[model samples]
Target: MNKYSVDKLPRDIRIEIAHKHRKLRKQRGLSQTELAERSGVSLGSLKRFETKGQVSLESLLKLVFVLGRLSDFESILKPDENLKHIEKLFDSKRKS
Candidate 1:
């Protein structure tokens, strides 16, 4: 496994990612409370994620599907460092 860290990410990019996540969530008409209920993520955790851009993949997947942009998410949420690894793994396993 390749280890990667967010330590090299610029502050602006981090902020942009958080903002984008929050914007998408809001565009789907979900209050943090509602999103938390539907996505099984805590309201506090969602709030922190909106501000920090650091949440578990499972929580993010739930939110993305609820936000009506699962396709966009399938592309955008692949952080650069993990892109090649994911591509290789998926290429090896045919999608049903």
Candidate 2:
């Protein structure tokens, strides 16, 4: 999906991206269903996006939270190289 591809992103970045999504949802004070209704996303898909990091079209739509200043969900979706570096440090420490 990215220029480098999803696989190129570090795992920590993936987790961070997932975490940011959850945080944004919570900040908006909307239940999964409410968010879905407003965003035109499905509840089940929303739940999966929150817990599993697997986003559906509906899940992507509910990111608007103008009332809560919780916008920019898309900006945080990108992968980070720092995550890969952190993971490598952990792996080396484990091996040691």
Candidates' TM-scores? 0.60, 0.50
Q: Mark the regions of model 2 whose C-alpha exceeds 4 Å error after superposition.
A: 1-11, 61-96
| Per-residue lDDT of candidate 1, residues 28-83 (tens digit) | 77789998898888888788879887777688778777787667755664657647
Q: What's the lDDT for residue 4 in model 1?
A: 75
Question: Tens digit of lDDT per residue, candidate 2, span 1-96?
Answer: 347665545545555666777787677676777777777667777777677767744446445453244455566668875698879899999999
Off by over 4 Å in 1: 1-12, 76-96
Per-candidate alpha-carbon RMSD to the true structure: 9.2, 12.8
How many clashes (backbone N, Cα, C below 3 Å) per candidate? 0, 0
After TM-score superposition, the amount by which residue 91's alpha carbon in candidate 1 deviates from its true location, in angstroms, is 20
Q: Any idea how many clashes model 2 has?
A: 0
Looking at model 2, residue 6 earns an lDDT score of 56
Question: What is candidate 2's CA lDDT for residue 25?
Answer: 68
